[model samples]
Target: MQNSDSDFFGRQGDEKILYVVRPHPLATTAALIKIYIISLAIFFVLVVLGSQIRVVSSIFYVGLQQIPEHLPGMR
Candidate 1:
C-alpha cells in the first residue's frame, strides 16, 4: 500500500519546502552591463582591424602549379 503521508516523488518525512538561493537584482544588472560593454569594445576593435587588412591565401596558387600535364597550359 502506498503511503498517503509521503511527499510526491516518494520522498518521506522531510517534507520541508526547499530554500532557493537568488542573487541581488542590482548586482546582477551591474555584472551584465559590464560584460556587454567589454564585448562591444572588443567587437569594435576587431572591426577596425579587419577594415585595415587584406587576407591572401597561397594554397590555391600552389594547387594550380601542381595540375597534371596533357591539360593544355599545364604541360
Candidate 2:
C-alpha cells in the first residue's frame, strides 16, 4: 500500500535560489573611458593610413615624365 504521508517526492524546502549581481559605478565609468581611448587610437591610425596611400599614389603617377627609350616596347 502507498501511504500519502510518506513524502517521497515534490519537496519545496530543498530547492536552491540564485541572486543577480550589479557592477560598481566607478568600474563602469573606467571601462567606458578605456574604450573611448582605444577607439580614438584606431581612428587616428586609419586617418594616417589613408593619408599615406593618397600621398604615395599621387607621387607615383604625377607625370608626363618621359619614359626611357630603353624600357621594353616603347619604340
- Give the winner by TM-score: 1
Which lDDT tens digits does candidate 2 get at residues 1-75?
332443324445755434335698999999999999999999999999887763323433576366566755433
What are the runs in model 1 whose C-alpha is more than 4 Å off?
1-23, 59-75
Clashing pairs in 2: none
lDDT of 2 at 22: 66
Q: What is the lDDT of residue 35 in candidate 1?
A: 100
For model 1, residues 1-75, the per-residue Cα lDDT tens digits are 453433345565767646545688999999999999999999999999998875545763666656456555423
The per-residue C-alpha lDDT of model 1 at residue 25 equals: 98
Supply the global lDDT for candidate 2: 0.65
- TM-score of every candidate relative to the true structure: 0.46, 0.45
